[model samples]
Target: MTDASVLEPNAGVTLVPTPNEDDLPRRFSDFATFNEALDYAAQGKRGMNFHDPRGTLKRVYPYSELRDDALDMARRLVAHGIQKGDRVALIAETGPEFAALFCGCVYAGAWPVPLPLPTSFGGKEAYIDQLAVQLASSDPKVLFYPAEIAEMTKAAADRQGCEGITWEDFATGAAPDCALPEAQPDDICYLQYSSGSTRFPHGVAVTHASLLNNLAGHSEGMKIQQSDRCISWLPWYHDMGLVGCFLSLIANQISVDYLKTEDFARRPLAWLDLISRNPGTSCSYSPTFGYDICARRISSQSNVAERFDLSRWRIAGNGADMIRPDVMQGFVNAFAPAGFKASAFLPSYGLAEATLAVTIMPPGEGIRVELVEEERLSGTPRDLSRPARYRAIVNCGKAVKDMAIEIRGESGHVLPDHHIGKVWCKGPSVMVGYFRDPEATEACMQDGWLDTGDMGYLVDGYLFIVGRAKDMIIINGKNHWPQDIEWAVEQLPGFNHGDIAAFSVETETGEESVAVLVHCRVSDPVERQKLHDTIRDKVRSILGHSAIVELVPPRTLPRTSSGKLSRAKAKKQYLSGEIEPIKLAA
Candidate 1:
């Protein structure tokens, strides 16, 4: 990806903030189509604001201007022979051009497929491969991206036999007067390829009604106020960032401030600085790692109170991954002097199949947790002599407005409260199906409810997410969540978040055993061996068995687009010998 800061010349003028108040009354996304929602929001003064690495504002795109550009792009699409349902792939960069093109695809009635930009981890070839796979699945007629990545994006597009155009070049195309197709409520809105989409990808097909319903639920769930603005650094390719922060702000008529995801990687503190300067109450969302990174960046000597003011940060949402309570506590501790309150930490549960939100913690009802024995989580009978061990399961709040959630057992029976089961949800916002993947869609859908593929239980109406059902490591007839092993390893000194990957592997004798790959940073052989032994002993204490522990170089683990560790991919690469462990005899 090109350095946008270098490509786009910065005007040395003060960028005014988009309005926090709109003359048009606030509505919880009642429009039938996203086009209609944008039309309604265009009447408001609120809009999107883009910031630089140091939290300096560079562009302020008002809704009216955005609507104008979108209509022009819509005409251009029509002139370019893009049909009502054609897939238009876009490299989702956090800025105005991508935003306009996305809405433009909507106006022209094309299903806009938002693809991810190259993340900090994956290099050129890996990114090209990733894009090629997703492009094959979505089968878009054309792919659009920044000019900087033309070489790589064009390669991927050529591999998939699709036309690839830079947004800059596409803007210069003919915008002749062409009739735009009218979109209905049930028309397919977009194709969402989830964060982990690769190898066999499933494009979640969502309709306009489904999208609007979800936007409404999330807006009401967060209790959007007149003085609310969103600040985000999450990649727009991910559901939480695309729907929760970007689309939700537009649909709800709230202005937003954005830091490029890569920019945030270079300077995570910029996210907080933008939040601190928000004219109104800040309502931002991120995966747990976002908070963890920000917290870790601020040291004791940083003078938090003097450097920031977070008194009006109304809703600090946590989702898209497991909401680690310890990380949340660490953030609170790091920013408590800056007026950041614990009550602002809102834990929620959601996925791409649900549009975005399945459940959102009610206003001011902060992060809540319940501890249960490891045996209950694993669905194994308790042993007589072993002392009880527990994990803190977070309260993911109740279902968003008009959504119903259920925890079903292995037999597909709805389980009672406090009984662990597979999470299932049904609502108007549920996706239509996976695009061109009926078998995959049928496997997860029962009646109208979507099997969320997440393992969790309910206490009354609130959800307590455990982990992904597919990510659970089972051995000797007992279930073990990969997060348990990963989090336990993270507790060791010299280890941080995303420093370890754990999964079941076949031993030489053909027995399934737990294998952990640690991201070793130490260079000295003696210290490296000591660290490996300590981690091995730690895993032994947790699992009560000797597991395979190998010290790999730092950044060995792969992450999903949302930045969560891809344990399945790690296991695949490790088993395939693609990931060579360091030369440490164990």
Candidate 2:
């Protein structure tokens, strides 16, 4: 009831990303013990509100109360045969139950693995298959799901011979719990599944210590205030949503208003509505698509300006995908009447392997963009200016404290700024490795730096993510593989020998992969129609998708300084809409 009881006991414990030995805070000596820092909120800390759109807002337990419940659940799970070091699969939509379940696993010393409860997976077959695969590979000792998904999950569990329990059944209204294991900070706290946009998804092992350190760094670097509130519609399955929105907000004892992913998709303005309804200094994050959705979807709707006030919005984070300058500008311009400022748009860069955040765009600054010659960009090492014809690219800002980033060439040598190569980072937040895949873990994590596979250069100490070296396509916060679409389109006669370039082009709806930028020499109109049909059918067949294919004359696709068809460059051209489907022979 008292404010003091709501604050965590370890509230002031700040972990140092880089220790000056003498200046190191004794309580924050070890990053691995960071979750223990949540003790700051152990007393009467603020509570988590699980938004029930159809029902009234219910206040769950304070940090202390939730910790007790988590301990109790850990006991129940152990009684049901869960052991220390065991993997526990949790498939629940984002809500209080998920937070509690994850905390329970952490207390029990079991690894919590959260998988996508993708609404897109109709019925139970696809999800069951995906879950089964994950469980079989992770070899989880127990699987937990909400009541709604329990039946289907149980069926999969039965087939896989794994133990399963629904949230309701697991609760059992049990008593004050059992003994907890002494969990080391370096111990695996949870497993995050790789987005699987490129290959079969693999689990990434994140340690409790790593998570705590990252949150501390993020809080300090981004200037997260205790009074701050967060409203998010990002999915819990992803790192940005889970780590950035849920964990960081709660650890900082901040109140959060979370909306379902579908809710925002259905009504983009709900984000604005939530901001208006909750009058506080709140900050939230989303991909570029989210902003575009707000601009396109909300602009057309009525009473938007009348319903929301954007003056209190301090930081509107845009990351996890390409940062579109036009989309950010459009949102600010359209919402200016509602008091939205251009400086509120905070573009950042991060990935799952890094435990979510890497850089937070400087607060209260306009999004930065650079225009350079497309031809000289690949080879020339200078920031030479070119004609204004070049497109605007956003700067994702600098790395957080204790995190060191480098742009390295193919030889692993760090390249000078403007010399694009793989973006690599070394920091306390980097995950231990991919779960069970030593080879992949080795391939990506070299020395101390994790090769992000994204291409970008640092300008004046700020990081900018350009494209993925692995050829992964991100659309609406979802990762899709280019090879998958390429293979799909290769079924066509002209594409059989890898003659086609299938890549994604960003649009107002996020990024959609165009299956073929067919380089046919033909210029006849009737033949072009046939080419379009052939490419569309091939894409739909293999990827269950179709793109707005462009049939350009041969050699239209620009090569990199090293003679590679730069997908990033190709995407730039598609976005400009200059290249069109070439005519075919009649």
Candidate 3:
């Protein structure tokens, strides 16, 4: 749509990041299709900046160059017999190639399926198994992955009976200039598999209209400013990363700097370093754990003010998992000396099924919490013998533009404010249904309202999430949220988030008991037993009964692609003996 030469960066120059302000006018995703949004973004001077593991700028990908690359890719896919509505699965690696390929499928009228890459704890076989399952579920005509994982990806592709090619090799294929298929507003733009889906995957089908609407919602919700630039280290495979950070930037004509998710894991301080280096106001989003890790890293570093300048961080958006107030507070306490403002912490709620964001905290409200009794959250009667315990439920803000939220009880009746129930949302941005899963689509939808499968209540229009509905553990007819159990263990010294997974398990007596699987780093037999006993006693204090505590190796617990702890998977693996527990002293 525009001259690529005008957007090209200076040759041999790798350190210059994209400009914070653009010459082109901001549109806020007013276009009908996502391709149109990219076309307009290509006309702007702002673009994407890629950084190395240490936060040094490596590649400068302007929108014009991305558009040209996508056009060439679209032509190549057409010449290769890819047609409208065909699924083209791409192993989502954060780079210009994947970006161009994802948009290229949009141009070609094919539904681009973004799949997760191999994570740190997930081994080769586990990664392959994950890939194969998603590949089979998406049923892509061809799967493209990075060259580094060609062997493993090929094995997965073979098992699914689909053609697999590395993106680098496929980039060299013949390209013939031809007219591309036209995409409409309602056309399926992409298929996204949520981070936690493992056994039975449902590819969340999002239309061009839905994606654009959600992007606009994010723009309005955040009150995006002309001087605002985004910095992110979130994975591209997750909704918050894929939609809010990447796609939202393009549609809104906002410049963004990115550090690979794995890189952030190795050097989290690099994320702060990039933010500190930003010349303009920065807007970034991450789950609570991301904030936790960064705060923990800076605790041992010297001179927080010298290492980071967070004053320019105008919007620190939190979502993609439960927003922990304690973690947020810890972040503020750690970075306040560095000019970090607690008011910049904007909490939100969303899921892939909603395309990206369903609710966003108002621009200056920051993180708000409401204390409710533990018995209220679990919907169980309190035992008068024990002192009352309260869990702080963080306010997840109000519904985004054109989105409606309602808390419904088990009887399918709408509940009043301050009443905990299943969270249901209705909006234009909500997906029509999961791809190729009509049964699931019907089960989760009621009269166009998508069941979010989360237990929460609305207070004066602000939604507060309790926990996942399916993640709740029922023991002896009482409900116990796994987060409450896991968080209790984390309160003990030396335990951190993701180190423990709690769930319900049946004992030899055929009665359900709480099982807490903790990641144990202690090797001494005495110390190991002591840690086990401590976690057991800690859990007992909450559950009011003895519970099962098993200490597994560090990183033994499984995490979803979005980095959330997967209690269901951990429970399944533990039951199957895949997760070996450390032997206790006789």
TM-score against truth, every candidate: 0.97, 0.76, 0.97
Q: The CA-based lDDT of model 3 is what?
A: 0.90
Best by lDDT: 3
In angstroms, how far off is 73's CA in candidate 3? 0.5
- TM-score between model 2 and native: 0.76
Better lDDT candidate (2, 3): 3
User: What local lDDT does model 1 show for residue 242?
Assistant: 91
lDDT for model 1, please. Answer: 0.90
| Candidate 1 Cα deviation (angstroms), residue 395 | 0.5
State the displacement of the C-alpha of residue 475, model 3, in Å, after optimal TM-score superposition. Answer: 1.6
Worst 10 residues of 3 by lDDT: 1-10
The TM-score between candidate 3 and the true structure equals 0.97
RMSD each, Å: 2.5, 11.2, 2.1
Give candidate 3's error at residue 251 in angstroms. 0.9
Which ranges of candidate 3 are over 4 A from the true structure? 1-11
Candidate 2 least-lDDT 10 residues = 15-24
